[model samples]
Target: MTAVKVIKVVGTSEESWEAAAKEAVERASQSVEGVHGVEIDHWTAEIEDDEIVEYRATTEIAFPVQD
Candidate 1:
Protein backbone atom coordinates (compact mmCIF):
# COMPACT_ATOMS: atom_id res chain seq x y z
CA MET A 1 0.00 0.00 0.00
CA THR A 2 1.02 3.56 -0.64
CA ALA A 3 0.81 6.50 1.67
CA VAL A 4 -0.31 9.93 0.61
CA LYS A 5 -0.17 13.34 2.22
CA VAL A 6 -1.98 16.61 1.77
CA ILE A 7 -0.82 20.15 2.41
CA LYS A 8 -2.60 23.44 2.26
CA VAL A 9 -1.01 26.28 0.35
CA VAL A 10 -2.06 29.73 -0.67
CA GLY A 11 -0.99 31.67 -3.75
CA THR A 12 -1.65 35.11 -5.05
CA SER A 13 -1.62 36.72 -8.48
CA GLU A 14 -2.30 40.05 -10.04
CA GLU A 15 -3.99 38.50 -13.03
CA SER A 16 -6.74 36.02 -12.19
CA TRP A 17 -7.87 33.29 -9.80
CA GLU A 18 -6.85 30.62 -12.31
CA ALA A 19 -3.31 31.94 -12.34
CA ALA A 20 -3.19 32.03 -8.57
CA ALA A 21 -4.28 28.42 -8.32
CA LYS A 22 -1.76 27.33 -10.93
CA GLU A 23 0.96 29.18 -9.08
CA ALA A 24 0.13 27.42 -5.84
CA VAL A 25 0.63 24.02 -7.42
CA GLU A 26 3.71 25.03 -9.31
CA ARG A 27 5.39 26.59 -6.32
CA ALA A 28 4.67 23.56 -4.19
CA SER A 29 6.06 21.24 -6.85
CA GLN A 30 9.32 23.12 -6.73
CA SER A 31 9.91 22.08 -3.12
CA VAL A 32 7.92 18.85 -3.09
CA GLU A 33 8.21 15.66 -5.09
CA GLY A 34 5.61 13.20 -6.35
CA VAL A 35 3.05 15.90 -6.72
CA HIS A 36 0.07 14.27 -8.29
CA GLY A 37 -2.85 16.65 -7.96
CA VAL A 38 -4.16 19.94 -6.65
CA GLU A 39 -7.58 20.79 -5.26
CA ILE A 40 -8.76 24.38 -5.24
CA ASP A 41 -10.50 24.93 -1.96
CA HIS A 42 -11.24 28.63 -1.95
CA TRP A 43 -10.81 31.87 -3.84
CA THR A 44 -10.54 35.50 -2.78
CA ALA A 45 -9.61 38.82 -4.29
CA GLU A 46 -8.63 42.35 -3.43
CA ILE A 47 -10.84 45.09 -4.74
CA GLU A 48 -9.59 48.46 -5.72
CA ASP A 49 -11.97 51.15 -6.84
CA ASP A 50 -14.48 48.58 -8.12
CA GLU A 51 -11.73 46.63 -9.86
CA ILE A 52 -10.03 43.47 -8.74
CA VAL A 53 -6.38 44.21 -8.07
CA GLU A 54 -5.31 40.83 -6.87
CA TYR A 55 -6.49 37.25 -6.76
CA ARG A 56 -5.76 34.62 -4.14
CA ALA A 57 -6.35 30.89 -4.06
CA THR A 58 -6.38 28.31 -1.31
CA THR A 59 -5.27 24.91 -2.58
CA GLU A 60 -4.60 21.48 -1.28
CA ILE A 61 -1.67 19.61 -2.79
CA ALA A 62 -1.59 15.86 -2.83
CA PHE A 63 1.64 13.90 -3.01
CA PRO A 64 2.93 10.46 -2.24
CA VAL A 65 5.39 9.76 0.51
CA GLN A 66 8.44 7.67 -0.12
CA ASP A 67 8.95 4.47 1.74
Candidate 2:
Protein backbone atom coordinates (compact mmCIF):
# COMPACT_ATOMS: atom_id res chain seq x y z
CA MET A 1 0.00 0.00 0.00
CA THR A 2 1.04 3.58 -0.64
CA ALA A 3 0.32 6.60 1.52
CA VAL A 4 0.73 10.33 1.24
CA LYS A 5 0.65 13.43 3.43
CA VAL A 6 -0.35 16.99 2.74
CA ILE A 7 0.36 20.17 4.65
CA LYS A 8 -0.59 23.79 4.24
CA VAL A 9 1.96 26.59 4.03
CA VAL A 10 1.93 30.28 3.30
CA GLY A 11 4.65 32.10 1.35
CA THR A 12 5.07 35.73 0.53
CA SER A 13 7.13 37.62 -2.01
CA GLU A 14 7.48 41.15 -3.30
CA GLU A 15 7.89 39.90 -6.85
CA SER A 16 4.82 38.00 -8.12
CA TRP A 17 2.27 35.32 -7.42
CA GLU A 18 4.36 32.68 -9.14
CA ALA A 19 7.35 33.63 -7.06
CA ALA A 20 5.29 33.40 -3.91
CA ALA A 21 4.17 29.91 -4.84
CA LYS A 22 7.71 28.89 -5.61
CA GLU A 23 8.87 30.26 -2.28
CA ALA A 24 6.32 28.08 -0.50
CA VAL A 25 7.54 24.94 -2.21
CA GLU A 26 11.21 25.75 -1.82
CA ARG A 27 10.96 26.67 1.84
CA ALA A 28 8.84 23.64 2.65
CA SER A 29 11.26 21.33 0.92
CA GLN A 30 14.01 22.53 3.25
CA SER A 31 12.38 20.79 6.21
CA VAL A 32 10.01 18.28 4.67
CA GLU A 33 11.54 15.43 2.75
CA GLY A 34 10.22 13.77 -0.41
CA VAL A 35 8.32 16.85 -1.48
CA HIS A 36 6.69 16.01 -4.78
CA GLY A 37 3.70 18.26 -5.47
CA VAL A 38 2.13 21.59 -4.66
CA GLU A 39 -1.33 23.09 -5.13
CA ILE A 40 -2.12 26.77 -4.81
CA ASP A 41 -5.19 27.29 -2.70
CA HIS A 42 -5.53 31.05 -2.96
CA TRP A 43 -3.72 34.29 -3.65
CA THR A 44 -3.60 37.57 -1.79
CA ALA A 45 -1.66 40.78 -1.86
CA GLU A 46 -0.72 43.66 0.35
CA ILE A 47 -1.27 47.24 -0.62
CA GLU A 48 0.87 50.21 0.27
CA ASP A 49 0.45 53.74 -1.01
CA ASP A 50 -2.36 52.50 -3.25
CA GLU A 51 0.02 50.03 -4.89
CA ILE A 52 0.66 46.33 -4.56
CA VAL A 53 3.55 45.75 -2.18
CA GLU A 54 3.60 42.03 -1.68
CA TYR A 55 2.12 38.86 -3.09
CA ARG A 56 1.05 35.99 -0.89
CA ALA A 57 0.21 32.42 -1.75
CA THR A 58 -1.48 29.71 0.24
CA THR A 59 -0.42 26.26 -0.90
CA GLU A 60 -0.82 22.63 -0.06
CA ILE A 61 2.35 20.57 -0.24
CA ALA A 62 2.20 16.85 -0.76
CA PHE A 63 4.76 14.15 0.00
CA PRO A 64 4.87 10.46 0.62
CA VAL A 65 4.24 9.23 4.12
CA GLN A 66 7.23 7.89 5.93
CA ASP A 67 7.42 5.19 8.55
Candidate 3:
Protein backbone atom coordinates (compact mmCIF):
# COMPACT_ATOMS: atom_id res chain seq x y z
CA MET A 1 0.00 0.00 0.00
CA THR A 2 1.06 3.56 -0.59
CA ALA A 3 0.44 6.63 1.47
CA VAL A 4 -0.12 10.17 0.39
CA LYS A 5 0.20 13.39 2.31
CA VAL A 6 -1.19 16.83 1.87
CA ILE A 7 0.41 19.99 3.09
CA LYS A 8 -0.70 23.56 3.04
CA VAL A 9 1.63 26.28 1.84
CA VAL A 10 1.31 29.96 1.29
CA GLY A 11 3.28 32.03 -1.20
CA THR A 12 3.20 35.64 -2.22
CA SER A 13 3.93 37.48 -5.45
CA GLU A 14 3.51 40.98 -6.72
CA GLU A 15 2.48 39.83 -10.14
CA SER A 16 -0.65 37.70 -9.76
CA TRP A 17 -2.36 34.92 -7.82
CA GLU A 18 -1.34 32.32 -10.35
CA ALA A 19 2.32 33.16 -9.87
CA ALA A 20 1.91 32.99 -6.15
CA ALA A 21 0.30 29.57 -6.33
CA LYS A 22 3.02 28.31 -8.62
CA GLU A 23 5.68 29.63 -6.32
CA ALA A 24 4.21 27.79 -3.38
CA VAL A 25 4.16 24.51 -5.27
CA GLU A 26 7.71 24.97 -6.56
CA ARG A 27 9.10 25.80 -3.17
CA ALA A 28 7.36 22.85 -1.58
CA SER A 29 8.65 20.55 -4.29
CA GLN A 30 12.21 21.43 -3.36
CA SER A 31 11.92 19.61 -0.05
CA VAL A 32 9.15 17.24 -1.00
CA GLU A 33 9.65 14.38 -3.39
CA GLY A 34 7.15 12.69 -5.64
CA VAL A 35 4.87 15.65 -5.84
CA HIS A 36 1.56 14.59 -7.31
CA GLY A 37 -0.57 17.71 -7.60
CA VAL A 38 -1.58 21.00 -6.07
CA GLU A 39 -4.98 22.35 -5.08
CA ILE A 40 -5.70 25.99 -4.46
CA ASP A 41 -7.35 26.00 -1.06
CA HIS A 42 -7.79 29.72 -0.67
CA TRP A 43 -6.36 33.03 -1.84
CA THR A 44 -6.03 36.57 -0.59
CA ALA A 45 -4.14 39.73 -1.38
CA GLU A 46 -2.58 42.62 0.40
CA ILE A 47 -3.21 46.19 -0.62
CA GLU A 48 -1.75 49.44 0.50
CA ASP A 49 -2.96 52.96 -0.22
CA ASP A 50 -5.64 51.54 -2.52
CA GLU A 51 -2.98 49.76 -4.55
CA ILE A 52 -2.31 46.07 -4.77
CA VAL A 53 0.94 45.39 -2.97
CA GLU A 54 1.16 41.63 -2.92
CA TYR A 55 -0.78 38.61 -4.01
CA ARG A 56 -0.93 35.70 -1.60
CA ALA A 57 -2.11 32.21 -2.35
CA THR A 58 -2.82 29.21 -0.18
CA THR A 59 -2.42 25.81 -1.75
CA GLU A 60 -2.63 22.20 -0.73
CA ILE A 61 0.28 20.24 -2.14
CA ALA A 62 -0.03 16.51 -2.41
CA PHE A 63 2.87 14.09 -2.53
CA PRO A 64 3.71 10.50 -1.90
CA VAL A 65 4.76 9.70 1.58
CA GLN A 66 8.43 9.09 2.14
CA ASP A 67 9.61 5.99 3.88
Model 2: residues with Cα > 4 Å off, grouped in runs = none
**Candidate 2 local accuracy as lDDT?**
0.96
Which residue segments of model 3 deviate by more than 4 Å? none
Candidate lDDT values, in order: 0.96, 0.96, 0.94
lDDT of 2 by residue, 8-57 (tens): 99999999999999999999999999999999999999999999899999
- Comparing 2 with 3 on TM-score, the higher-scoring candidate is 2
Per-residue lDDT value at 25 in model 3: 91
In model 3, state the lDDT of residue 58.
98
Per-residue lDDT for 5-39 in model 1, tens only? 99999999999999999999999999999999999
* RMSD to true structure for each model, in Å: 0.8, 0.7, 0.8
Best by TM-score: 2
Better of 1 and 3 by lDDT: 1
Clashes of each: 0, 0, 0
- Indicate the TM-score of model 1: 0.93
